[model samples]
Target: MPRSFLAVSLIALALAGCVTKPRPPSHLGATVTVAPPSKADVWQRVASAADAARIARIGSAWSEGLAEARSRGFGDEVKKEALLLRSGAALARPAPTPGSYSCRMVEIGSTPKKKVAFERFKPFFCYVEVEGELLTIVKQTGSQRPAGRLWEDDVASRLVYLGSLALGEEDQPKAYGEDPARDMAGVVERVAPFVWRLVIPYPRNGAKLDVFELTPVTEQPK
Candidate 1:
């Protein structure tokens, strides 16, 4: 072979080796240690892969579970995070004490109409109690801004999502704040108690679940 030809062949062989070099197990299939998806990722994936109805079902269950968990006095950050993921929102209000009241709700879509309920802790100004599927803590500050537009928007979005899933092509655009048709806004009247209710069978089952109360309980004795 000619010297120049031999040199070119050697260079080509070297280049081929470089191109075919083995990768680390972490970079290769099977052996790769892929990081588990985050909570947000799971939510997005559920929303994306599953049909809208399935997503709505899961969202409802998830919301219901959150209310139950939080009511049971689970103070871990994950509990709060789970609630937030289920379209839960809290408005800061000053309690009679130094603490604050957080009102949360879940918007559930069912046949005939959509149901909205307080998860627990409506008159959160006086209760430091956490029960099964409910939590009410008294805040020192008496009058803080109620969870105004923020809570309303959160609930509205939940309704919109559920509506879209249930109604399919008839899904309507969301209207936040005072608008009735767009927002389906519900008032937090003292007569009603908590802001969220555990209405409708969860997991879309035939049977109904517990009706959680958001009423504030008397301060627990230390």
Candidate 2:
């Protein structure tokens, strides 16, 4: 062959050799083994001992107020005032010994209000160590707004503790006059091993009381 033809043939062969082979496609249906997260990895530390104790006291007072209100069949105004007094006293008293707790978001209870869905709320389950205090803090979750933004701009309470008790007021929509913005209390009773019931008096007079039946997130289907 001519020198130019020979050079062109050699270049073509080198280019063919340099071309990379195509890789096989990955298996779309293949099972992926993801190790479950370790307890340390999943548990989040959100509050210190002092903070937890203060919150607990506030919650306890609220719970007590609710119980009293229900027993007396008090009106809305009476219940609200009672809660205020209880919460104030709780704060003024000497702080109790601080306790430690590990908290994680759990399931919320169902509600009739169409605007508010319990599933959307990311409530917390706190396993406490200060004299065996266990409580749950129910708060709205999955909001597009930035962190630190208040849920619905309403200052209602949602702290429920063991011993069939809870401290926190129910949230009333804006359509209703201002949210009570008070610390209320109620009962947290265990219906089953993993199932719990939360009962709180309705903030509005003559309205039906609120009841929440909650279960762990692990029990929910994927």
TM-score, cand. 2 vs. native: 0.25
User: What TM-score would every model get versus the actual structure?
Assistant: 0.21, 0.25
lDDT of 2: 0.33
Best by TM-score: 2
Q: Alpha carbon lDDT of residue 182, candidate 2?
A: 29
As a whole number from 0 to 100, the lDDT of residue 110 in candidate 1 is: 27
Give lDDT per model, in order. Answer: 0.32, 0.33
The number of clashing residue pairs in each candidate reads 23, 5
For model 2, how big is the CA root-mean-square deviation?
Answer: 18.9
Model 1, 70-173: lDDT tens per residue? 44454353344342333334233311121223433333222223232223324333223333432223222223211111111123222211111112233333
Error of 2 at 77 (Å): 30
User: Candidate 1 at 16: error in angstroms?
Assistant: 16
